[model samples]
Target: MIAVRRSETTLFTSREATHDNDTVALTHRAGLVRQFGSGLYGFTPTGERVRRRLIDAVDAELRAIGGQRISLPQLNYSGIWERSGRWESFEGEMFTFENRDGKRLCLAPSHEEGVVHLVDGAVRSYEDLPALYYQVGRKHRDDHARNGLLRLKEFTMKDAYSLHADADSLDETYERVRAAYVRLFEALDLAFVVAAAENSVMGGSASEEFVAPVETGTLDLRHCTAEDCRFGVTDESPGWASVGGICPDCGGNLVAGEGIEIGHAFKLGTRYADAMDLTVDGPDGDEWRVHMGSYGIGIERLLHTILAQQSDDAGCRWPDGIAPFGASIVPLAYEGAIRETADRLYRELGAGETLLFDDPGQTIGERFAESDLLGIPRKVVLGNQFRETGAVELECRDGTTRYVDPDEVAAVVSGTRSGD
Candidate 1:
């Protein structure tokens, strides 16, 4: 069981860091993250728990689709980028520097060139054609990072690359990955739209992005408002018709909104493979350049988008699978019978999944506020009601309250997985 104490963690209030963005303000006040610099932030313990759950969810989806998880180097030599003819193209956005030996190096903003270089000679035949490699790690960029985690100089990303013998094979994997991304976001309960996106720097034949609509989002998107229509397009896409334009598929009304891009899928179509000489011999002994696809999901950006859409004036309201703790045991007073009962329930409900509010200094109202601020899904209150009737007050995040026998607490909370 991971135990957390209020006094042991750094939590801010609304009075600190006066910002116009409510999501940013609530993030700090909830102790989810701490900003180190303009574009850099570190996750607190509470935040790390939620992040791990999100990452695990992503991993499960990708792995189920035959994505082989691998770790790639964060720092890349200029030779790889130059060979791919992207060193100069990515000049301003990539973090480039000259090492002590006068050789230029860069913190990779994306791993297309480096990943291609890593598998250049190893994959020598069509049998090694459909290779899907993915990694979760830090990616660096030189953007004007602002709006909390929406834009950051350094951030965590889940990037996957697929190599295929031909465009048809690449298309097969692209659709699979696209489906997996939809399932992932759906499982997280995020309201998002998958839109045709522009292949700008990544340079691909086609691309699509999973965008979550939020007021603080930077991407402009047009989506059909019809219940049956799922048509959407980014403003930068070639197929983008202006807002109030007719929906190409369903002839529905298209509305414009701001959205954050959480995931992107690209049909690279031999762009990197040809530029970097990633080739394989065919069954007929002919040399063929491998086609490629790149997919990415910004981890922190997804987390922030959830907060942007789900948080209320009280605090954050985490989705089912990503809450930091499944249930919190908040006793009105931690003494005598209340303390013993709360401790017993914590153990019965699985200590790791349940948070016991053991701090005695605060009143019951203060404890309830703290529990709501943390966005715990369920609150098990051992109060005067428990003392009189042996029934614990069960409060859910949706503002519903009920009283259940002490023994039924575990079964009720166990209906969902904890922090998974």
Candidate 2:
């Protein structure tokens, strides 16, 4: 039942940035997002719908693995970070401020320190080991944020931390979370690579990153071309993407490309545990440090990555699972049998996140054009086709059209969920 006149929509146009990435331009043109500052944006209703769908998909995967959802404060006391030895490391890059009482605080760039502090006193013995907790919240940093959603000063992240008593437990949970990330990207219909990576600020021994290959990415990597080989590496790795660009495993020539890093996981054996002095009573009645691991996925980066890879000159082509609306009804006229049939279909099937109707006084051509720009997966026209015959014209994002009964619209659109 959500209908809007295109003229009344508060969509503002945006100018291109230094990188010349058109996602910013196209997204603004579609009325999905607006920029208030250099890397800060406000999501319009249409953009927020897509963002919600993406988060829902991620949350479902997290809950499937027994993850306890929690919320952490965005403002954090600097004392905790000082204890972790990261205060000096993040000196200029963190948003730090001091109050009149000389109490120092900073906007949280990541919550590893905060999360460890929360679990510091909750459990006391080995039996309380292997705790898995996660939170979806805003993370802030003062770095040079650019390139639309790929890089931002403030962005949303789904960060999960697990506390284990032994390396075996940590290894098991790390692999589980990695597999869950694979499922998440697959659900979004994105082709991605899980590459061996360095644990830069997120310290650990074994680390990996989930990267999506796109033209607008800044991270460099070389991948193997062998059918069974799935190896990928960053430029920081020694002999990685070597002068000959040879694959280490199969000795085949490698292909170099840039990728957007969407998710990162680290096997932090005692990084945080030792720093925070967190320990538990072991089976031998001795104090033992807890093994820890952290995993994170950028929410907005996923949205922009999908647009960078899946869009064409015509406009974006939203994957069925992440599309704002599953379908749209564009009737040729606003009156007579056309409106009547459109209304009936809207009531029975177009309700919820399923449908939208462009009912402005513009011509049918304008309505169809805007539908393409919005990237709606499916479109139904209750025009002369429905008035003359009982068949409604159905149009797909691919420009294919078909005539079907009004009653069949729901089944056809709902069936797309399976393929998505």
Candidate 3:
């Protein structure tokens, strides 16, 4: 069992409030991340644990959809962007500089041009079409990063691109990817909506965004009033006001709200392939421009959105699969039988799956408060109850408490206790 002492990491649970948003406040208070500069932050140990789990979950979903994982370089030659006719358009937002060798290099904000160039000569036949490649890496931008993790100059992103021989093939892969995204968000239990969005710099035939509505969000969204209808549109779309405040699919009234965008999918068509001269020979020996689609999930933005939507005034309350630790073992006093029981329970529950609060310097109240702030799902207490009656108390994040025998604590916390 991975036992973590309260004194190991500097927690800001008792620190003074420094931010206006409670979500951002709790993020710092719980020791999730630390800022180094404007728009730049580093993840703490607990933060890295949660971040790694998020990446693993995203990777699993993409791999299940036949996406081959590959790494793309973050630094790219400016010539590719020039060939794609986007260098001037993206100059204001992209990070470009001249290397010592007198060559212009850029920290890519997106990989449309780079990916096409990477596979330029590799895809020479129609059979090689419909290739789906993806990567989870760092992306750079020059925006005024603020609002905690909502906006950052540099962030992690999971981006996938698909090359197809025809529009029909592209459409099929796009829908599959859309479904995969739905599954992922639902698994996280996020109240998100898919909305038709503007292509903007990506310049695609069509695109959609996964947005989670929150009071602190900045993206304006118009969603259907009907509970069963999921149609919505973002104000970024041109002529959005012409919709007459109605859902085109169900004629339901539309309501406006602010939201944070977590993911986006674009049907790029032949924009990048045509610009970069990536083509595949058809079965009839004719050269045809490859169709392309790209999908992106903002890793840090999604994490921040989760905190914004799920956290409360007390602290964060992570979802089932996303919590950094499954359970925390809080012994009222780390001595004698109490410590022995806590250690035994930690062993039974799997050390890696549980965190033993073994620090003896703090009072019991402090330990309990820290556990709650960390959003641990279950808190097993070995206090007077255990000493008097041999009954252990299991405290859930929702404020529910129950007593169970020592042997049953694991099953009860895991929801595998047979009797109920």
lDDT of 1 at 152: 97
User: In order, what lDDT does every prediction score?
Assistant: 0.85, 0.79, 0.85
How displaced is residue 397 in candidate 2, in Å? 1.2
Off-target runs (Cα >4 Å) in candidate 2 are 1-19, 226-229, 238-244, 249-253, 352-355, 418-420
Instruction: Tell me the TM-score of each prediction against the true structure.
Output: 0.95, 0.93, 0.95
Task: Show the colliding residue pairs in model 1.
Answer: none
lDDT by residue (63-156, candidate 3, tens digit) is: 9999999899999999999999898899889999999999999999999987898889988998998889999999999988878888999999
Name the weakest run of 10 consecutive residues (lDDT summed) in model 2: 10-19
Worst 10 residues of 3 by lDDT: 411-420
State candidate 3's TM-score: 0.95
RMSD (CA, Å), candidate 1 to true, equals 2.1
Off by over 4 Å in 3: 1-3, 12-14, 415-420
Q: In model 3, how many backbone clashes occur?
A: 2
Error of 1 at 71 (Å): 0.3
lDDT of 1 at 266: 94
